[model samples]
Target chain A: DAGITQSPRHKVTETGTPVTLRCHQTENHRYMYWYRQDPGHGLRLIHYSYGVKDTDKGEVSDGYSVSRSKTEDFLLTLESATSSQTSVYFCAISDPAGGQETQYFGPGTRLLVL
Target chain B: EDQVTQSPEALRLQEGESSSLNCSYTVSGLRGLFWYRQDPGKGPEFLFTLYSAGEEKEKERLKATLTKKESFLHITAPKPEDSATYLCAVQATGNNRLAFGKGNQVVVIP
Candidate 1:
């Protein structure tokens, strides 16, 4: 409950389409992260933003991209959604500079690509 | 890549039963270890963060301990409400990213 919120609690989209998930935070933390959770694979990072306009790839960033235009918002986009992309996406925020390396998460967004 | 492995996959306990969950990790260098609890269809809730070997943290009926290569979460006399998936994660020396374990699903039958 660290003032983090993810949009689109659930969605069903067709394959080969574009999808965007939004993560908004009120804490104004310096770092924000995006992750996808699967049944057997736990949670894997997709992308993260350290500051506004600064982003980096994570462990599973093959087909994903992210952008942070403002301090409070981070967006993850899939240019062409695939069935394998159907999973629950979680947005996390952390403050590493403030000596708090722990990341708090949002409620999450569940996406299904058919 | 930092790797984390959790054992048993799942657990079942009667109310008032005490138990422990294991999390083993391999990283180039350890920065921090974290423990979280997740109810089904919900996000993970932070529980504890252990900074070094021999470090320990506790809350309510739960305690988390860390060693060189692994961590343990002990539940003391758990109740039905204590049932949830416990997740473990590690942050390596050079990065702030966390590598998470598959999590241990716990069921406490009342």
Candidate 2:
């Protein structure tokens, strides 16, 4: 109940189309992360931000990009969508000062590209 | 490389039955371990955090114990609503990154 919301709960797009998903947090946490989950394979980190204007790629950073201009908003964009990118995307936030080292997740956004 | 492996891909238990789920992890320098529960079509919910070996934590009917190599989540007298996927993740020292295991799927039948 830390006030995290993900926009466009579900989306369907065509291959090669550009798509963007939004994640908003009201708690103003310093750390934010983007992850994708698929069947049989567990969740994998896509990108993370340590502070405003500071972002780093994860293991599966190919074909995806993220930006955090404000502390409350983190955006994930797929430059050119691919069928392989179809999965459930999640956004999480954490505060290391308030014992917030543990990440809390959003409701999730399900995406399908055909 | 940090790797995590969970055993018993899927488990089915009847109401009032008790069982345990296993999470085995291999990290270069262990910093922290976490447990999460997730339902179908939803994001994961945090359950516990273990920092050192021989550490144990409990909540309601769930108890988590961590050792040097693996961790176990024990459920006692499970109910029908206890069915969900349990996930394990480990954070390495000096890095703000976490490596997660695939997870253990548990189903409690009424």
Candidate 3:
């Protein structure tokens, strides 16, 4: 649980529509990451934020963008989602500054694009 | 790129049966290996973290051991409550991203 929560636990949208997912944490961790989990693909990173206003692209960052306006809030936006983007999205927080890479994930958001 | 492979996508065992799940990984330089349990429609829950080879960690009915190239999660006398998908992930040195295996689904029947 890690004091993390994701908004819009489930959503259905048409292709080419825009969608935004929110992740809020109370731990005040330094790192926040957005990942998508699909069958046969485990979890793939989409984007991450190390600090407020500081973000980076990850392995599968193509169609996804993230913004961390505050320490406890990270937002993921898909300008135009496609069917391929339909998957279970997860938000994980970690403070690797302590030398541990273990990430704590949120409940998750299930998205379906038609 | 780091690669993680978990064997036997699905496993079923009777209550009180003991078994082990395998997670093999290939990475340029391993920093840490992590184990997580996921239940239906829920996010992954962190279980243990092994920093280096020969490192071992344990919880109530689960024990995790790590090697240079792989890791094993041994379940001792499993129960129906233990049924869930076990995930293994590896974080390479100097990297903040985790490379994870698809997962191993375990079912314990009473």
Candidate order by lDDT, highest to lowest?
A: 3, 1, 2
- Evaluate residue A7 in candidate 1 and report its C-alpha lDDT on the 0 to 100 scale: 93
Top model by DockQ, which number? 3
Comparing 1 with 3 on DockQ, the higher-scoring candidate is 3
How much lDDT does candidate 3 score? 0.95
Cα lDDT tens digits, model 3, A1-114, are 599999999999999999999999999899999999999888999999989999999999999988898999999999999999999999999998965467999999999999
Docking outcome class, model 3: high
Candidate 2 per-residue lDDT over residues B28-82, each given as its tens digit: 8888899999999988999999999999999998999999899999999999888
TM-score of model number 1: 0.98
Q: Cα miss at B109, model 2 (Å)? A: 0.5
Superposed by TM-score, candidate 3 places the C-alpha of residue B71 at a distance from the truth, in angstroms, of 0.3
**What TM-score results for chain B in every one of the models?**
0.98, 0.98, 0.99
The ten-residue window of minimal lDDT in model 1 chain A covers: A98-107
Model 2 per-residue lDDT at A82 = 100
> What value of lDDT does candidate 2 attain over all alpha carbons?
0.93
